[model samples]
Target: KLPPDDRLAVLLGVIFCIPGSRRAAMDDSEEDDRGPDESPKRPLKGQACRHTASKSSNDDEREDGANDGQERPSGSEGSPSKKKSRDNIPEPLSSLHGLVPESPPRFVSLEQIMTTANGVTNMMLAHEIAMDDTFKLTKQEHPEKSLEHTVKKILHQAFWQVLEDQLAENPPNYDQAMQLLQEAKETLLGLLLPHNTSLRAEIMEGLDVALVRQQAEHGTLDFGYYARLLISLMARMCAPVRDASVRDLLKIEGVVPLFRGIMDQLEVMKLDMVNFTIQEARPLIQSHSVAYAREKFRAYLETQALLSPGLDPLVHTRAWLRRSHEELRALSAQYSPDPVLNGRGASGPPFAVVLAKAYIQLLCWDPSWEYPETLSMDRERFTLLGAQVEECALVASVLLVTHSVGGASLQDISDFKEDLRSHTRLLLQGCGKCSEEELTEKLKCAASQAIKEVQESLQKHGFAPLQLSQERMLYDQVVSMASAEHHIRKLLTMRILDFIKLTLSSASVGPTKIPAGLSTLEKELTQIAGTFLRLVTHNRAVFGEVYTDIMAQLRAT
Candidate 1:
């Protein structure tokens, strides 16, 4: 080593080791898609996903290539498919074909295949884990003290006893303890920043392994001094969350125990740093995530293209866009004779319209067909989101219908509202795949309960209960709300759709406050909506060209 400033010449002295440094590195690819419902009081988790578009000529915030979090995949590379005219916009020579094969791909190495597979798997898993509403890296103390815990303690005690015996020998063998100390020094340095010059110097000088080795050779090495010094420095540097553990290190008397405490505290601090880094990176990640994910996916797509042409990476993508094109046509026909949709005016919906419709399909996706490769990472998320929407919609509709029928009679029934909401929501637990008939049955049950609760409330309050005819009319109306054709159900669904539609369009960025009338359903629905919009927004930016081509073809026809 060069000098004491060099920091690692303590060859034959004690050092510490911790497993915390082995944690998998986390990238800034998350869009804050926090989703969970263990506690209804807690809002859905994660930040709104954002992606900018070329159509907006966004001169505002640009992360990677996104502007204002609106989505436009082509950016400066290309333009969106315009409303009426197709000028300055190029057209695809042939339709996107995922079912037909053109040519077999050349041989690809196993290494290449494994590399791409790992990257894709890691990206998907990381997002899924971090998306939990209460996800945080934690180290539980004592952890119920199971048999395994006892066994681990015994093994650790035996090892420390052997180490104690070794140190007590005439000339102590510092081999293992030295290794541990070296490991600790490396870990502490890992926690430092370039600007932390004074702390770095303090750590390097205070724990100088060279000087420690010299002292050990002369029978004068003070293990407690090193441990206490490390504890002192850590107390100054650690996050407040770890302050208690650092202080507890001072209570230990034996060298082995003190060193053990030091390593344990170091691990906690290491994990603490990780969690802090993730929290700090959230905003930056949100801003650049759309573009960042696109670049990663682009690289993966190219690799797949070269490896296996027969296995088109975008097969589901083509199918997804095709469905949107069909939807756009149906929508246009449904509102025909309108100048804008007929191409006689400039008010027609752009690719954003088609894109919104496509995302809506995810709410009730056919489970048999694999989700689009572009959205494969979010299949589980979209499934849960579908349930949240249906749940919110059902809850709101039930309450609205209940109040209408129970009017005045159940006016003072404060507890009835909460009761109805809880009962209706309970009927929908794990209802991701409920059939149309099953849903109607659930709604019928909800209707009966509403009436029962209303009668009980009215009788308890000494008010006249509803007449039989009134109950019959109320029951029929509530059950009918189960059908998609019903006005209230359809209206609520449309409002939910509008919320998502506006959220996806560049014209409606920062739509945290939605339109009125969805007050009861806004909390949970908004969370899912923000995540869905962001995922779709980033996805659209990545596949904007494919969508633009499909839109152009549909418009031309």
Candidate 2:
């Protein structure tokens, strides 16, 4: 067996052969034929020339593999990088053939640039070894000149190869090696400042000195050191302005708008960088994010207290939403490294927000509440019964409010109050009626007509039909609430008719006799109307001008 060092070098060279093995042997022969005056041909920029040579060699190897009846791995076709790596692995049976002394030694044609990689690594290691040897040896001339010449000669060639390796990946490991290249550009700018008229000036203008130096100094580049440097550079590049005068200028009300514009641009740039990072990490990110979300949701469901049958469905819904939001937030935090699928900010709402929203919608589609199967409403308490399904309407209204705004500002509260007052006044005036069946039927017909009129009025006010998902949800809630209110009103009207019939029968028996519950019924009717009025007012903002027009018409009737 060969010595460990030579074995490792041969191992690396063979490993990196790719498709260049055949060409390397042919090139070796051609170089031998040429006179001593002709130097070996150097690999071109970007290592494209060497890779092209490798491709030809690999095609032959692929055919050999096929002839030998080796099956190609599935999914390798989609990933050229993977396929290349797979092909680089030499077969055990092929290696055994090399042991036959009767057969000639195998001609492993590793790419020319890769063949030099070990040399570069050893050269740097030798410098370190020389430093350690200096402790024991006396004063000696440093080999800096020779070392520098060797490094300068092959530095760019090695860099292109390294870069090619980095780029040829699906989710490129762009953290350190790429940053070294970037630093090289920045360092060259500084290097140029100090050398205004040096011979290096022309080369430095187009060359990456930092990258060349980094490759030469270390046996293997320290990814950790480069990563940290990248972080610092990124921070400095993206740091907030710290100039006192500029900050003071920004604080001035007159200059605020300009500052706002600057801030907007900065924010946009930040988001773009975040999106780019997320895109690059997509391959590294696994399908586990979806599974993680499901797991979290399941955990939340397990911990929920759903044993109480007395709880209103709306109350249960609110509880569920609150818990789901919390769990979703945790899931989002877990997936902070992954790209957000819902177009939310990196730290915006949880990944579960979409899931929770869906749940809310599903629940709202068939919302249920505690209500009597048949309202046994008396004339005296008929109005109270009208408010029986008020909780359902209120719950729907609350959802609308929550969905519309994350946080209610003072202006929002003020607007809500004003709308409530206006809507309440209109509803009370229109909805109030003396308890009687015939008039109730008339009001019902009028309400139906008014509903259509309200919708038309909304269109006239330049409000577009609900198109956004949120807008549609809010509209659906409005229709549900209206349907529930209509049902209650009908039940109340029937009770009033019952009372009127009873009063007429009693009056015939005793001419001066008043119905026992006439006064009480009237009071309940007004109170019930007031309750309905408040509900209508609370939701008028969502329904818009259409609701206002309908309420106004109903009041007029």
Candidate 3:
């Protein structure tokens, strides 16, 4: 509207006075603050054009700035006459800030992205349709293509792309990548559902690889995530077509092998983390989907059973009388070594003692209550006396081992015994309620029968003749092991008393049915009774009073 010079001066002043001018000024100040030894800052003289361009030539100045690849300067510089002359020029014009140079447009076009994404999607869809058709043909008659192979290929492609993309980007666009992966997974799952009979094994294999990658990347395995993913995938694949043949194909055996393979790989790759992961996953593995858990547990049990003998070596021996003396010396060394005796050493750990007791219990159970097929032993009649004996031995072993380690107390043993007795009584009462008279009569008859069987078995097994000698020797060992402490003697007395009470109670109730490959309760009890009797005989001077008291109690009963 005004004269050309005035209009140009106004335009120049506006361009130079923009917010970008402050930014450019601050940048210049920062550069000056860095000191002169760093990169020398060339003063931006071309920026003066922002305050000097003619109104008609403002667009031309912006084009020049873009072409020259130089930033526009802020503020006036030099004498007032020079500033006035520069201010008369028109300001530069730009789509962005007028003070900064514009960058040249890059060559990559958005059309390329849209076209690539569309082409890939279309190709994936076509492949899925082709796979479905092939699966249908294979089911009908032509077996040229397998559904498992097709699904495997699709999953391999999808997972490989995801892994590649993740590795290429430094902090990848993870949300978008995850979405794409999820879509790929869903599509593959859809294809697999209709052809589940043929695809389950391959699908499980693919899942195994994915899980392995996840574990390897994270260092710790997450059972819940893997479990839920598997469950969802299985549900999807099995929901659409419910065929018996297809269901059989989806059976746990086929799927479990793949998961087992994954676990094996994890063990091999990250052995240190495996134990921690297993411990954490224990509850998850046991509670969620119990059928699958049971199968896995059975497999683990079978493996453990195969390895048990090599790990514990004491299970295969019998001839107690012949080996009893030799084992005593070894037991002494194991319990209180020469170094420990000389050095005032503490006892072994409580857990070690627990482990030892568990071993002894296994021996007492084997070939006594539940005869193994390998042993070819005849089954004995049920006797509450035998059950009592097994229970007493287990309790005594736990007490002796725990007490020997200097960890557990006599009070703990007594408390545990009371709990056990209460539980046993509750179990018996739950089995059926009878009148007091009927229960007493049954108890008397069972006790008499048990005594007769014990006498016959002792005679047959030659235990009666060997009992005195074994008891004497074991008693001496117990005294030496206990250092003649009143507490030890008291603990031993409690063990005997508890055994007798449990025996009488068991006799009153009748023998409990044990699992196969375990000894009858009566036989185990007789063995423990003999063992205890030996202890008393060998330590008569120290334990004689308690032994007499126990004998009187047995007689009275």
Which is the leading candidate under lDDT? Answer: 1
TM-scores, all models, native as reference? 0.63, 0.16, 0.17
Q: Indicate the TM-score of model 2.
A: 0.16
All-Cα superposition RMSD per candidate: 15.9, 31.5, 33.7
lDDT of 2 at 476: 44
- lDDT (10s digit) by residue, model 2, range 44-71: 2233433567766776765555443333
Clashes of 1: 19
For model 3, residues 417-496, the per-residue Cα lDDT tens digits are 34433333332331112344543443343333323333344455444432444434433433332222345433543454
After aligning candidate 1 to the native by TM-score, how far in Å is the CA of 128 from where it should be?
8.3
Deviation from native of the Cα of residue 83 in model 1, angstroms: 60
Positional deviation of residue 203's Cα in model 3 after best superposition, in angstroms? 4.9
- Score residue 147 of candidate 2 by CA lDDT: 80
The regions of model 2 sitting more than 4 angstroms off are 1-264, 275-287, 294-485, 488-557
Q: State the lDDT at 70 in candidate 1.
A: 36
Candidate 3's displacement at residue 334, Å, is 27
Task: Give the range where candidate 2 is weakest over 10 consecutive residues by summed lDDT.
Answer: 371-380
lDDT of 2 at 419: 43
